[model samples]
Target: MKTLLVFEYRRGKLTEANLELFSFAAALGAQTAGVLIGAETLLPAYPGKLYLGDIVKCKDYNPEVHADIIMQAAQKEDPDYIVFIHSSYGWDLAPRVAARLKAAQVSEITGVSEGKFETGCCNGKMRRLVRPATTKAVLTIQEGAFCFTGEAEGTPAVEKLEPSADGAGLEFAGYEEPEKREVDLAKAEVIVSAGRGIGKKENVPAIAELAKSLKGELGASRPVVDAGWVDHNRQVGATGQIVSPKLYVACGISGAIQHLTGMRNSEFIVAVNKDKEAPISEVADVMVIADVMPFVAALTEKLKQ
Candidate 1:
């Protein structure tokens, strides 16, 4: 089946979610085409057909303008399937594309096997499976739910495409850059996450010190994020970024339903809490019963020495 994979670029290069879409598209045994709007020079080399719509300009992103461009491309490719990532951008554009094409949108897909798409249920009950109703389908893949593979069997043929005259009329008015943060989650090898048990706003720096000692990223639960102790992007939960670092240390987090949805997939989970009966202990590879602040501080100082 022929497939068109749409990805949003920042300053010309493909974003993380785009690379993820390629991985999923490759798995479906569909011929791949990448639809992008930017200078072709910014994109890293890829094995696929490439199309550029210079008119779809945005310093960052504008939903309506983006949707219009994608719809135009969908008409041009008329592929059996169109794929998007369930990211900030995908959330805005996927439904619009589906509406214009009159296609079934199978979105929030967490797992994809040979013939079925798997999605998460609220309480880890059973994963909902959706089979394609027709040969033509539109899907938005859930980011962080799947790992990426660099090896695809064959190199795709690349081609240049020009947008239609209607596409040329749209304009990118303005954009504001997203708030910058100190860490990049995708590249973090080790992560240290804290829960409400840290007790007070001032104590977060202790966990930060541990992360610093280990040269890792600091992540938090929803409460910590809501408390304004850290950036929202640092949250490790269903509503936040999903990370799969080499070693994940959970401090004071009780492993609540919402929190586990994010970091449950970590390679190694270590929980530190005074109560051995804490829910997080069940999933932790190592359980430490202690006050989070003291333990984190001692650990950080020890590591430094």
Candidate 2:
């Protein structure tokens, strides 16, 4: 069955989630097609036939405009499935598209089997949760859910289809660049994440030391973000950056569903929480039940030595 894949290119590069989605769509017996809503110049190489259309331009992301463009593509392709990566942009646009098309909607998908989607949530601040149902549906695959493969036997043919210049009354105002930081969590090979168990803002130094020793990025749960212990970009959860690093060491995180939904796909998950029964422990490849500060200090010293 043909599947329409919605991908956005930013700053002249395809988003990582789109690459993962393309890899997944290939495995699901779907002939992939591409869609984008920006300057066509931004998209370098699309794997499959391109749905050539000029989306309504806005200074920043406009869900109304984005949803309209996707729905417009859906009418033309009428493919068996539509997919997105459950990122901030996807969450904004997916539900609207699903509602307009009267199609099933699935987000934060971890796996797919027999056309049924499996999903879970993970955030350190809240309790665990699971999505109980799945359907032959429109899905926003979780960022780390699928391992992306850039290799293809032959470069997929690229064709651009015309889209009429009509959408909700929205026009491009201008552009602004987001602030840059020293650490890019998305590319971090190792991450040291702090949770409520990390105690106070003062305790974060221990974790930071550990991260420095390990040459890793420092991450935080939503509470730490809300507490202003770190920059919002440093938070890792449903609302934060979804990271799939080679090694993720979560300290004092209880493994809320929203949080887990983000990082459960890591290659190796190592968590240190006092509660062994904490939901995070269930998915952890290595679990250590201990106090956050002492563990961090000890681990930092051991690594340094």
TM-score of 1: 0.66
Error of 2 at 256 (Å): 6.1
Local lDDT at 94 for model 2: 81
Give one digit per residue, the lDDT tens place, for model 2 in 1-305: 77788886554456766777776686677787766766665563654566544443433455666676676777767777788887767777788888877778877777776666677644333332333243335778777668776753334344444443334566545556656656679899999999889889988888888888889989988888898987887888776788899999999989876688678878999999998888898679999988878888888989989
- List TM-scores for all candidates, in order: 0.66, 0.72
Query: TM-score: which candidate is best?
Result: 2
Q: In candidate 2, which residue ranges exceed 4 Å CA deviation?
A: 42-47, 55-60, 122-136, 150-176, 180-192, 205-219, 231-249, 255-270, 277-285, 294-305
Give the residue spans of candidate 1 off by over 4 A. Answer: 55-60, 123-126, 151-192, 196-219, 229-247, 252-268, 272-305
Candidate 1 per-residue C-alpha lDDT over 1-305 given as tens digits, one digit per residue, 9 for 90 to 100: 78888877755456766777777877787777777766645663576666665634433355555666666667777887888877666767788777777878887787877767887554333468888776677888877555576753444354555433333455555666757756567568889987789998888888988988999999999998999987787888766777778888998998764577577777888899987777676578899999888889889989999
Cα lDDT over the full model 1: 0.74
Q: Report how far off residue 42 is in candidate 2 (Å).
A: 4.5
Q: What is the C-alpha RMSD, rounded to one decimal, of candidate 1? A: 5.9
